[model samples]
Target: MNSASMHPSDTNVGMMLVISAPSGTGKSTLIRRLTTEFNAFTFSVSCTTRAPRPGEVDGREYHFLTREEFLRRREEKYFAEWAEVHGNLYGTPRQTTMDLLALGRDVIFDIDVQGARQIKSNMGQGCYVFVFPPSRDALEKRLTGRGTDSEETIIRRLAAARHEIADSQWFDHWVINDELDSAYQELRAIYLAEKTRPAYRASWQAALSRQWGVS
Candidate 1:
């Protein structure tokens, strides 16, 4: 819980982290835990063509967009990455994240595999983490329990989940969501580890050496 312990890297540069998981795998909940607990992290709100659900707020939950507007921006290269899921289009803007990273804020994206890949290709940076449900049965049950989607939609999501799970092999880290607290701890540890990587902190080390009058 100590911010200093979590972030020992006093570097001016920040990292971009992309978290991808199947719809029912609880990635969103895990992301909330990280953002709430970590002071150095910020969430990148994505644009989506999907209509807001109950209690969802515009810009806060997502930057709501019409299909035409989404496609227009996509064509203009405004999005660093974009993908369509369950007939809805979602995208992360390039300028938003770049500006944040330039300001030394770590940015986290809650996106699908497609968008994650595109972000890596475009930005050439980011750590990808994929969360998996304990089992297919557990995933299905979680989706059903939401009651936000119809049975048909739930079935579609389950089918998509199979492919998403397979894609986890490409991710930098895999966290299984068997339990909320356990999964969150695993994710937090991964973030801390990435932040402390030698490459990430090399410049900071040099600066400290200079301050201490080390040759």
Candidate 2:
């Protein structure tokens, strides 16, 4: 089998890369870089009941929905995974995600731990990664430095960070965002390695089988 001839685009199955981290752990930045660098990776835009932030566009950053609409969709099981975070309801649309995967597009998720747990339970496959800050002080500094949250909200987020980190033990990989460039490299490597997994390489296997005259 000439495995070297197999290209990434030849893969018939896509990967569900689920990533979770505390609010200030730089998870969003990493995901942005990944999707930008690797054009094949698709960012799963989630539906959220929270109002869009300044300069955030609807259907780009999130599919902004009213609380009533969100609840109605939740009851219909329209979301692959949904959770309440910071008092806002957020959910990943079920059909959209499955359709992308069916088309062999690697979908990446930027969600909280609760959402990640729901995804793991509902879908047993895919890779789960947890991002951690270098230290407690660093996390606090980042949260406070944002200046977007009130003092009370910052404290609440810090507390939630602890809980999220504790629950992250079940993740398949953990990346510490001490240095942005180094962390990005490590994350990129993980995705590249995951692409080689047997489940994602059905086309490659078929090509090999044909070369060997196997049924």
Candidate 3:
């Protein structure tokens, strides 16, 4: 789609977006699928201290950091949002995200509930969505089915999910991932719908004027 055809303020094609979820809710899977399908999105890279899982690349999966490295950067106020997940710290570097958005490219953030809220508040305006599992049981099964976490970890995640779900109402939109393909379709629809919101009309008009040479 051409810029002139969109809202004047509507930078829909190139905007930072936060996709949040509790653990094992398929946020990563969904993001992977999107990155495969869309060329405009750059998955916002997050820094973390956790060891990489099998087949996960360092720069692609996360910017794996040492405890000292994370702390040093943390003290420098470099992150837009940071949090500790099971003793490992993770964060989104602020400048990288802003740089991407300034270039009119979409930065996709895959983060937990806490960091998501911080990014939304700090970024001021951007697309924020909570990815919900079909059901609690499904979440539990997915987590364990991977066999990556211990039972204790699973329970802790479930407890955390209870709080996350409570906060979903606070976000702009929600996508219940009962089925993966359907959820992706819904997410795509939401993106298009956002472009048409009244707030975006001025931008669309400006773009059109520029295109048609209307003073």
Candidate 4:
């Protein structure tokens, strides 16, 4: 769709946002808040081979698949980005995310660092945001407090978190999840500011100028 025929708020040139963080960093919670506040944003439902936890619904939480099925899909290149995290496979569907952006809807991905990096490479134009824990102590407390994983799993996750933190330089923006409200505000500001950047808004601005007879 051309910008000339679309309203500023309803343009088809939407953005792809890839948000990455280690487990228990409140990345999911912050993303939930952002999507709720911004009606124009659509959360991309990822495909996973992991069994859903209690209170997790199909399609809403994830598209659960068996290992065999996931492997088959991976071979077919159905995923934009996929990675094994803590023994479970997670992936984002390539076509669906592109379809959303083509229809003027911002797509948000809450994925692992590996998957986020793959998406950035595949799309080459997404906003990469890395969420960090306020402190190592806080990360430990949060992971232990979740009460979902075994001690072994927690140790593995903490190790993974350290590796992910080391890759923070790959991200375009960073938000520290010290307090939920403050962290969310920082995330929201990054998104809003990105949308207003000259490179992103140039087409819309040109369309507006043309409409106003700017010569």
**RMSD of candidates 1 onward, in order:** 4.4, 2.8, 4.3, 4.1
On lDDT, the candidate that comes out on top is 2
Reference-based TM-score of each model: 0.79, 0.85, 0.76, 0.80
User: Residue by residue across 43-161, what tens digits does model 1's lDDT show?
Assistant: 77889999999999998989999999999999998898988878999888898998888777899988888778899888888889999999999999999998899999998899899
What lDDT would each prediction earn against the true structure? 0.86, 0.89, 0.81, 0.86
Lowest summed-lDDT stretch of 10 residues in model 2?
Answer: 1-10
Candidate 2, 1-215: lDDT as tens digits: 46565666788788999999998999999999999998778877899999999999999999999999999998998888998878998899888887888888999988888888888777667899999999989999998898899999989999999999889899999999999999999999999999999888788777767787653
**Candidate 4 lDDT, 164-188, residue by residue in tens:** 9998897999999999999999999
Candidate 3 vs candidate 4: which has greater TM-score?
4
Model 2 Cα shift for residue 152 (angstroms): 1.9
RMSD of 2: 2.8
Model 3: number of clashes? 6
**What TM-score does prediction 1 earn?**
0.79
lDDT of 3 by residue, 110-134 (tens): 8777887888777776788899999
Q: Against the hidden true structure, what lDDT does model 2 obtain?
A: 0.89
